[model samples]
Target: MSPLLLVVAAAGGVGAGLRYLVDRLVTPAAGARFPVGILIVNVSGSFALGVLTGLGAAVAPELSLALGAGLLGGYTTFSTVSVETVLLAERRRWRDAALNLFGTLALTAVAAGLGLLLGSAAA
Candidate 1:
């Protein structure tokens, strides 16, 4: 395997482990009513990816790929979010479903923008 692929694979493992730990830490208190764990993961991953993208111009390609394409890619779970939202809608929790859909989009976007700004400033 190529060096970059090895780096990405290792980082992906770390990212997946981190996601599992974060979900375990955050999910139980909220119960199964909503996907709070996934929301947090997605939003945080968005911001992290934004930072990585913003820093790309100033950083090495390998670092950016390892973190952005590998770590954040492994960490974020839009599929889970989508599935949970569908489940919520099926259960007639329209408000919760809408909140999950819009809230994740809005928040992750804002977080990514902020991360970009911060990363740009740092660079």
Candidate 2:
């Protein structure tokens, strides 16, 4: 395997570990009423990706791939969001479910846009 691929894989493992730690830390404070942990993870990941994208030619392609596709890919998770939404719906918490689904989408998009703008300016 390529050395770059190995770096990305290692970075992904680190990212996943970070995700787990963040969730564990935030979940308790946010409580079981909502999955605030995952929400934070996705939004932050999206923003970081936007920054990398905005950096454009300033960042090397290999570094970008390792951080974007590897680290952030593992850091952010739509699957958890989907499962949580379904679980909320199953419990008949329609409002929370809708909020989780739509809210996350909207928030992450905005975060990414903002990150892009900032990243571009910095670049």
Candidate 3:
């Protein structure tokens, strides 16, 4: 495999592990009504996504992927996000579940796009 691919692969594994650890640490306090894990991951991921994009824009193009994709890729947990939403909906927590589902999709897209725009603009 290409070395870049290998780097991404390694980043993915590390990101997944860190995400799991973070969820375990934060979920209990977040409570049953609110999916603290999804919220934490989503919001923090948003902030980090913004920072990564801003940094890339103000610094270098390469910084975007290295930080955005490498760091944020692992930091952000889509699977968990999906599962949370599904479980919520299944359990009849329509409000919370919908928020997780639609909110994440809309926000993450905007964040990534903004990041890319910022990164490219910086370049």
Most accurate candidate by TM-score = 2
Per-residue lDDT tens digits of candidate 2, residues 1-123? 999999999989989999999999999998999999999999999999999999998999999999998999989999999999999999999999999999999999999998899889989
Give the whole-model CA lDDT for all candidates, comma-separated: 0.90, 0.95, 0.72
* Model 3 TM-score, all chains together: 0.71
Q: Positional deviation of 59 in candidate 2, in angstroms?
A: 0.7
Deviation of model 3 at 39, angstroms: 1.8
lDDT of 3 at 17: 78
Write one digit per residue (lDDT tens) for candidate 1, span 20-109.
888888999889788899899999999988887877579888888998888888898888889989999999999999999999999999
Descending-lDDT candidate ranking: 2, 1, 3
Cα RMSD of predicted structure 2: 0.6
Model 3, which residues run further than 4 Å from truth?
57-63, 103-123
Displacement of residue 76 (Cα, Å) in model 2 is 0.3
Stretches off by above 4 angstroms in model 2 are: none
User: TM-score, each model?
Assistant: 0.93, 0.98, 0.71
